[model samples]
Target: MISTQKSFEKKEQGSLYLVPTPIGNLDDMTFRAIQILKEVDYIASEDTRNTQKLLNHFDISTSQLSYHEHNTNERTPQLIEKMLNGQSVAQVSDAGMPSISDPGVELVKAAIESGITVVPLPGPNAALTALIASGLTPQPFYFYGFLPRKKKDLVASLVDLNKREETLVFYESPHRIKQVVEQMVIVFGAERQIVLAREVTKRFEEFVRGTAPDVLEWLENEQIRGEFVLIVEGNSDIEEEAPQSWESLSLKDHVEELMENQDLPSKKAIKEVAQLRGLQKREVYAAYHEINE
Candidate 1:
């Protein structure tokens, strides 16, 4: 059994409480989070206005300080100093847990370096919330905060992650979700399963789950709205191999496919196909010889 009184008494001075607020629904706020915010000397919030709304709803009158990304470097030291003076401060984001896709990591590091105790009060998180309802494998998963914006960068990122066996989770805005989905189809394949969770816990809460291409098509027919959490299934090692296309007929046919389908030069296409299919240059040459003969 845990001893609540002992734990409270042993609480070190200059402690930092990493409190988690609701991602969308107010009811998701844990009781411990509220108590910590109320008892702490000050609250550090990502957005004061948004945090203020939550405070007002809970009737919490605790004073708050801004600790967003832009101000974290300048303000972290000062916040640490306050903790050193025996003040217990709670760090919170506009929504969800501080530092997990929010801006409390720097402060936590500072507090730890200064010998301050840091405690996390878990409550709600959009990533985990979306993952559970995604219908994808939940045990092994990877959280990628957000997708890169540049088309090339985004494609490169997805290509590297294509080998991972864990489900991929990412935060995305409505504006770019469709584009990201389209790129995902190119890198991960159209048949890959995907889940899109939009406006979670809000009135317009929605979950769209299907193959990458299908989901992309669905998004096109609806108005884009709210923040989105995307969960994509990873590569499977046990799936049956796809039937080889005409491109797989021989090294010659492979080169032809690249020319016809991918618009690559014959020489470059032959080299690319050989590398992709793991065939020796001599073997590819023999197949090409047979085609010509």
Candidate 2:
């Protein structure tokens, strides 16, 4: 059901405003955003102390409540209740837009379930800022926020992500950029073109563009600092290889062939064959182990 309400004109309960703050430069803050910050009754901030600086600079004296990941479970209901009682609220992150790899999404969902209005304001974001100048395809892009920290899970995730056909965008910190690119080279191949946009909208802003191997070479000697937005070209040359013939092989032999060819463990290879043949995992397991017995 698509329900539309005339924002700022309808007379009812309070609204939830999602305001965007400047990513780095203070000058990027819009005038209307400043007015909304001042006009709202209370602000739900990711970091109250960090938001105070932005508030103090514009001389906006709105009260704030800490609403980060750690406190969202307890704070979301309180914020929703306050809005239900007709107290206007504005949600903000430490920087950039609220709920983009941030903590405002739960609160927004809570508010909507309770029938409170949500009003989102458009403004600065790190990913799009870097992408427009990245010289990569902007449309049909995938904005995959921070990659997983663990190497195994990260590699597995990248293995699945490597098949995507659209340009991929990601946010990465300085410390992991080099290692992350190295891993990308393994999954996506060394010749895949990638771009790193660093410290956007700030004084030392930079855009580094090259193949994955080329960037890995640059990171060897230079000191890495600042946050990063990575743009990678899609796999346009994905080869259409023919599937291996399983017609002549029995169930046990097919599982063995997959284990050797795909470098999969017995259990994993059995599961793969089951999925490929629309058979149950237990059935494949039984067939494979029967030969071993």
Candidate 3:
């Protein structure tokens, strides 16, 4: 199951390039990303109409095939077939990176399973961009893209996320911003630090930094618009405890144990072990997946 990719190496089959688009400011688009989109045989877009505006701006005439949440099941195989036939494809979301609170993960998995080279071209990402400027500890941060919409699920999730000792990052729409902040006040307390970054890299880009209560009060006075990135201070009062016997196990096994016992997904479970062992999340993730990188 160990697979390694020398991303740029020439191969018989074409590669699947995960190209990221600008989050807001069109000027933020990278030259390399643009070039890949132009060179690809086809561009699998989340929304062809929206992507057309971008294509027109950049003058990229690559043919596009609609690929979004609803059409993923059907479009995946067709796109995979193209790549298998030696036609390269660039997968792009409506905005930002593909698979970050958006479509493309399933396609990525399918490409990997099909032995197609998967190349990621990094660019604008709202979560990391917000975290660095949020005045919170950036390293060892947990990026939970978006929380569940259900009131019960959101509260339950926050209660579990509250125990971590690293900064938490979340994405929220304009409508849910106020509700999410109010719930944070109840679960994470009024004193916990919270930073709200919205309209990222746009003309109206802004960041609201204050305690949970402070942010909620501000929301009540203003009209919420644009997407929001919520950066929350982690639990600082976690008491240090003796290392358990489980710490002796391999990193992969440790993550699996946490997943089974705590009912955590691989991403959350990996974050837990990363915080406990003073390691980067990527390092733990690689170990768990047996990836050389």
Candidate 4:
């Protein structure tokens, strides 16, 4: 029979701590995260070299084991075994909070399934930092971790998001930021408000706020650098209508007005008017059909 003494000792020692490291600035590391890293029996890291640098900076001498996307499947079970063997452990990503567009979710899930005590410590996050300073509507925002790299998928995703009335936040690498911004011009319209933040919480922190087309043009003139956090303004209450001259005109005439004024498609024009009038697309279609009928 198993000894009750060993079980009680295991319960006391086995616990999992999730720690957040700074994203760009070293100063963003929290006191609690530092303390946990120092005290934990072992630390799991996305990149041992990167975590070593942070550890050295903070004077944390805790042992580290590599646990990232490449090795997570193989390493996770072993790590859980160690925890089960009565060892307090901590997990950290290269930067920012673990399991947040990072590689700690699976490990956390494993620990939970094993009935290990899991704890999370607060720290720096790039997306939230950029969102607060974006000068856009803050409440009811959507965090879309990263946009698709391919053009077709990216445009489709943006189109889908265009239907939502909440601010959208996304991360984009420096190389893709300009292309993403240009596509945003097509999908969300040239004049939709956008805020581009770079090097957040670092020495080179910068926020550029303007219309999509304007920002796209500005990016073209300058060299894009550093990690980027993009925030797009959602649909506004103020409806941008076709010119008044087209109000009393035919459906075909209205389409022409939109083409001249907004350079939009016939279907898009109809949809815009339908939204403004609080009617269905088919209702607008029927009016157009009757007009031509």
Worst 10 residues of 2 by lDDT: 3-12
Global fold similarity of model 4 (TM-score):
0.77
The C-alpha TM-scores of every prediction are: 0.78, 0.85, 0.81, 0.77
* Best-performing candidate as measured by TM-score: 2
- In the predicted model 1, the residue pairs found to clash are none
Ranking by TM-score: 2, 3, 1, 4
What is candidate 2's lDDT per residue for 167-253, written digit by digit as tens?
999999999999899899999998899999999999999999999999889888779999999999987887776766996788899
Clashes within 3 Å, all models in order: 0, 0, 0, 0
**C-alpha lDDT values of all predictions:** 0.86, 0.91, 0.94, 0.86
- Give the per-residue lDDT of model 1 (tens digit) for 173-275: 9899999998998889978999999988888899999999999899999889899999999888535557767544766777777789988877777777788
lDDT of 4 by residue, 1-293 (tens): 33122222346547888898998989888888889899889999999999999999999999999999989889999999998988888999988889888899999888878778788787899988899999998889999988898889999998788887899999889999999998999888877999999899889999999999999988999888998999999976545556766468765466556757998877888887677656778777777667443
Model 2 scores a TM of 0.85
Error of 4 at 24 (Å): 1.6
**Stretches of candidate 4 exceeding 4 Å from the true structure:** 1-10, 237-293
lDDT of candidate 3 at residue 177, scale 0 to 100:
92
Model 2 ranges off by over 4 Å: 1-4, 241-276, 280-293
After the best TM-score superposition of candidate 2, give how far the Cα of residue 291 lies from its true spot, in angstroms. 24
